[model samples]
Target chain A: MSEFLVLVVPMWVVFTLAAQGTILSGRTGVFNVTQEGVMALGASVGFLVSYKMGSNLVGLLIAFLVGALVGLVLAYMTTQLRLDQFVVGLALFFATTGAAGLLYRQVIGVTMTPPRVDTLPKFEIPLLGDLPLIGDALFVQDYVFYFAVILSLVMFWFLQHTSAGLDFRSVGENPKAADSLGINVTWARTWSTVVGTGLVAVGGAYIPLPFTGIYTDGMIAGRGWLVIALAFLGGWRPLYVVAGAAFFAAMDVLGQKAQVLGLGIPHQFIEMLPFVATLLVMVFALRWARQPAHLGMNYDRESRLVG
Target chain B: MSTMQKSETGPGGSPPVAKPEARGPGILTNIAWTVVPYVASVVLAFFLGGLLIQLMGYNAVDALRAVLTSSFDTSFGMVETLHKWVPIVLCAYAFAIPLATGKFNIGAEGQMLLGATGGAAVGITFSDLPMVVLLPATLVAGVLAGALWAGIAALLLVRFRVNEILSTVLLNFVSFKLIDWVATRVWPDAGAGHPATTPVGDGARLPLLGSAPAMHSGVLLVLALAIFIAVAMRFTPTGFEMRAVGDNLRASMVNGVRTSRLAGAGLVIGGGLGGLAGAIDVAGVHGRMLEGMQSNFLILGIIVGLMARGSMLALPVVAFGIAVLEYGAGTMQLVSAVPVEMVLVIEALILLLLLLSDLVRDRLRSAR
Candidate 1:
């Protein structure tokens, strides 16, 4: 059980962080599909910077900043230019994927042996790490795992308990009304997109820091999309998203565990489980999922507001 | 979209009277607006791509010259471009069809893969059959496979209200795994080093267009499909309903259109076209199902679809432009030693620049 928790915790952190980012952006009426590509960019950049600087935090920070830069472009396209969020998100996705691949090749030339770096070391708390059942899994982790949990909690409080959070929700729910009430819908959207993508980049950083210890072309894989599913699964709420992440991550761990046990089933099927689970969950739970009212619609002040 | 049209139509089907002086831009300016800027954007993307290669230490002018000359300078290059144009155009239709009904189908990659797998399965299994029988059977199998793959998303949407976009994206991952399994476990090539299925039967092969460059006869099929779709869209009631659904779903629903059926048909047709692309690829070019061949086809298709912007007539032109860039990029890499990934970067850059320019143009127009 402890072993299982150890395997699942970091996955949960990364996924929930991404889900949290999606929720944040979605709450401000921008449904970002570029998370997948942006996360890839983060993973690639994180690995490169960390390898060069020999500092995990700096690398993660750079990755977050890169995500913010990309998010700025997205915000400009969706908010200022009033383009279709879906199409713009996809275009940005393609750009990031291409940019990440090109930059990686440029930074680390093609070789038979791919580069690797040391993963972030675990930090164990004194008495907390000594706990019998939950110590290593919960109390002992790298700074990222702790930071992810704390960030999720802070975001939960930020989105729910604060007046700013209420204003943010109001902007998402009805931007015109929020604008009339002086909420600065544009500002809300821009910040949410920029800052939200920063957290997403942190989620992406986990791919290199904990999971892989190296960057590969497909490192981010479908985790970004999975987080999107998780956001919807959680109904855009932080704690529920964490719970969804835990469940999804547990399934991921279970797949690995099954493979480790040398089960006769083809590893491909095991590899396929998470995506399949996502599809099933989306199909079953989507009807009841409480989506943001203006999720993918661009807010244009000049255009006649029509419901 | 229909709101503007409806308002212009006025009450009781009477058209609003046109004002002579209040008319919008002249036909020439409208044509320029539609054509010139896009042409310039493509040129700009090419120049930027050249700059990117130069920054990477290759001679930009030399690289760009080689790319242009090699890909479009000779008959062989044009044939190669045309060969590539088939699948790219088909996949563009695959993406655009469902998009016409306001549904996002990003599963063209998966559908194409499954379609190839199905085509290969049928071709390999029915190798003894005559050409006439086996070819159609293989094509039908591929189309069915693609439709069924997309049907999963369609079903989820119509029945359970699942977002098609998410479902299709997830299904793409699933299809990759499924294809890998099909290659390795289900139809493993006898003692092949890597996982792959047996080559398709000769009976299933598409006839070649010419001796040199070896373009497939499937180009004719593509032309036919495009014309048929254009005609149907222009003349048919079902097509009108699809446009209606696409323009405004709520209004279409109120007007008693079965939006669900339109959505289903559009997606299935799109999926079918994607599968046909795979079928043509295997039978016409590869003669077998190739692993990872589905790479970036969906993105390219989406790019073409987006550039076409719901106009079926514009698809071929946009697809041809992309095909030139793609084919040129390969030659450029080989000749100039630039990394082939630069093409993707160029493609992305082109899209971004195009969007920015369009936005700027719109802002300027509104200001005026």
Candidate 2:
């Protein structure tokens, strides 16, 4: 049971971080679907940089910066140029995916045996980790896990209570109104995009740095898309997004546990738990979910009409 | 919102010239406005791709030359290109149709997988049947399975108000596992080591067209379908309605068009074509359903559709262009040790440039 919790909790952290990024971008009126490809690039690039630098922390920082840079490009294209968000996002996804693969091949070369990295060290809290039942799952983990959870809380507080957060949400809800009120909608959305995508890259970097310690082409898998689903499931709220991530993560771990226990059911069906859960959650929970009014619209300050 | 229409370069941009008696220069200028930017984008992408290859310490020109000659120069390469063209063309059409009805059917990968699975399942099950019975049955099964998979998303969207984009994407993951189950457990080939179904009988196989470097006859089927789609979209009321709905959902609703129904039909047709692409791969190329045969067709098909800009006539040409890049990239990888994923880089660059070219086009028009 401890082993199961250990496996499940980290995934929750990774997914929570990703969902937070989605919410951030979505709040800024950019439906960034490039998460999957960005994560793939993050995994590959993060793994490569760490391997070369011999410092996991440095690799993660570089990964976050790279993601922010990509986000900057996406922001410029979508907001400044008045291009279609979905289309440009899709194009960015492809570009990042290809860039990752190309860079990997160029740097690593094709090898009969792929290389592996050491997982980030886990830190057990002094007293809190000694508690029964949930201690190990909650208190003992890599720094990234704590960062992910703390970041979510921070994001929730930052988005709800802060005046800057109100302005950000306003820019997303009605850019023209925000602009009329002296808010720079373009700057808010662009910064949100950069920060959100950077956070997403951290989630991506977590896959290789702390969780797997090895990078493969399929390392990111569909977790990036799952992050988007969870964000929607949480109604674009930070805390509920964490809960949604945890639910999907638990389902994923449970499926593996069922396979281990040989529960007489086909493992394939069990493997589908996360996706099915996402679908169910969306269908039932989305009724109460509120989206940014201009979630995927391109904003132009010169144009009086809402995009 | 309507009053804010500025000098934007996108779908709203119009020629600056006042109405004139001379229509010939106007049409030529319009054609140039569209064609020039697209051509420039494609050329830039190829040049950038070559530059990347050169930066990796390989001869960029050599790699590109190899791509051209290996995929189009020789008879074998030409035949292979045509063989590959069948699936690309079908998949692009699948994506294009959905876009026309304001649907983004990103589940082409899932639909294609189910199509292949359905084709192989029927083909192997009725191995004793004659060609006429077995072949058509397999194709029909493929089409139905693809449509049914897409229909799940459509139903969810229309009935429950679940977004089709999210539903379709979720359904793709489901289809991947479903196909895996079918290939590995349901009809695993007796002596085969990999996750694959038993081979289809000869009767279900598509006939070859030529002697040496023979291509499957599925190309003919795809061509006929393309022509039909072109005529339908160009001349028919149904196609016009789909386009109208795509243009403005609220306006179409106000105008009494059944937007939901059109959305469903677009998905069905799109998914069916995607399935047919997979079916052709099985019946024409592979002779059995194999795990991971879907490859990058979904993304490639979407890119092709986008490049075509909703023109049925332009779809095949774009698909061919993509096929060339894909095939050439493979050869480039072999010769220069460059990653074939570079094709994706080139495609994305082309798409981004094209999107930005609207700005460039507007600037040029204003200058004129």
Candidate 3:
């Protein structure tokens, strides 16, 4: 169980960070559907940078910056040009996905064996690490795990407790009203989307660090899409998202470990658990979970429509 | 809302109202207006792609030439492009049909795979059946399976108010595993040395068109489907209602249109077409359901669908263009050592540029 928990924790960080990033932009009315592509780009960039620079930290940072650059384009098109957020996001998704592969192939070339980087080293939390199972599972981890926990808590506090966060969220709920109140709707959206997307890339970057230190195509799988579902399931709340991420991570880890678990069902069916479970959960999640009123809709201040 | 309105008003929108003073120049200019953006976008995308290829240390001119002209240079290339076009166009329909009712069906990949699995199952089970009975059964099974798969998302969207995008996308991952199980466990072909099902009987294969480099009859079927879909979406009342719901959901609801039901139907239909693409591939190309058979059709379909900009008439043409580029991508890689990913990047750039052209045209019109 402790071993399972250890696996689940890192997976949780990926979901939490990605979901939080999604909701961050989502709350600011810039619905970012580029998570899948951005995450792949992040994995590629993160893996490439770490392999070259010999530092995971640098890889993570560069991944964030690269994701931020994509976010900048998304923000410009959706906010300034007032193009459809989903359309622009989808376009960017394709561009980034292709770029991810392009960059990797250009740098690595075709080889019999892919080069690897050292996985992040786990650091024990001194006294806390001495606890039985949970400590080793949760407390004793790499800096990325700690960063994810702290980031989730900080995001929760920032979005729930701060006036700035309220202003930021108002842009998604009612951009005209937010603009009328001098909230700088565009500015709020731009920054949040940039940072939010950066965090998402950081989540992608984290994937290679926890286990395999090499990046491969389709490594993000459908986790990026699941993160979107996670954001919605959690009602775009940071703490709820953290909890939701735990469930997602558990499902993910279980799916990966199904062959070892010796479940009677075929491992393929086991692998389907995360997606099928998410579908089932979504039915119930939508009952209580309410998304930002204007989540995927572009906000036009000059438009006559009420929203 | 504005986005829907803009798409509805774009060149791909409903046919313009005939004016009493309609003349040659007016028609010519209209043709130019429609054609220029597409040409410009493609050219500009190629130029950017060339720069990227050059930077990557490849022969940009040769690569670009290979990408554009490969399909036209040889009979084999033409047949391959048409074969490729079958799935590309069908998948585009899978996407565009749903978009007509304001739902995004991103699960075409899953639907197609399920369709292929469904087709393969029918083909394998009725292996000894005459072609008259088996071929139609295989295709119908595929359509039903695809529809059933998409119906899950539709049911979730309509009954539970779950976001269709999330539901559909998640369903894709589920389909991937489902197909893997089907290939590996249910109908595993041990001799194939890959996770693939046993090949369907001869009766299930699509009839070939020519002596050498023969194209499958599925291409002809899809061509017919393209025409049927174009006419249906443009002239039929149901299509009108679907388009109305997509254009203005509240307005359609106020007018007593069964918007939700139509949206659900659109998704099922889209899924059916997606399934047809899979089934066609099974009957025509692969003869068996295999892992990774879905390829990147989902992405390509979405790209083609978006590029069509809500025009049913434009979808097949755009899909064909994409098919040419896609088929050429392999030749480009062979001739110039440029990665196949460059074409995807170029295709994406074309989509973005085409979208940007809308803004540019809008700006220019307002300035005038």
- Candidate topping lDDT: 3
Candidate 3 lDDT, B1-368, residue by residue in tens: 24522343332344323334757447666666667877898899999999999988998999999999999999999999998998889888888899888888899999999999999999999999999999999999999999999999999989988889989899999999998899989999999888999999999999999888998999989989889998998799999999888877889999999998999999999999999999999999999999998889999999999888788887888899999999999999999988899999999999888878767766765677
TM-score of chain A of 1: 0.96
- Candidate 1, superposed: residue stretches over 4 Å from native: A255-259, B1-26, B74-76, B366-368
Candidate 1 lDDT tens digits, A148-170 = 88888998999999999999888
Candidate 2 clashes between residue pairs 3 or more apart in a chain or in different chains? none
Docking quality category of candidate 1 according to DockQ thresholds = medium
TM-score-superior candidate, 2 or 3 = 3
lDDT values for all models: 0.82, 0.82, 0.89
Q: Over 4 Å off in model 3, which ranges?
A: B1-25
Error of 3 at A258 (Å): 1.4
Clashing pairs in 3: none
For model 2 the local lDDT of residue A52 reads: 89
Number of the predicted model whose DockQ against the real structure is largest? 3
Residue-level lDDT of model 2, residues A1-307, one tens digit each, is: 7777788888887788778988998887888888998888877888889888887888788888889988999899877777777778888988998988888888889899888778899899999998887889889988988888789889999899999999989887888889899998878888999988988887888887655687889777678888888887788889888878878889867765656767787777877777787887777875788788888887767665555
lDDT of 1 at B296: 77
Give the Cα-based TM-score of candidate 2 against the true structure. Answer: 0.96
Among all windows of 10 consecutive residues in model 3 chain A, the one with the lowest summed lDDT is A296-305
Residue B145 in candidate 2, Cα distance off native in Å: 0.4
Better of 1 and 3 by DockQ: 3
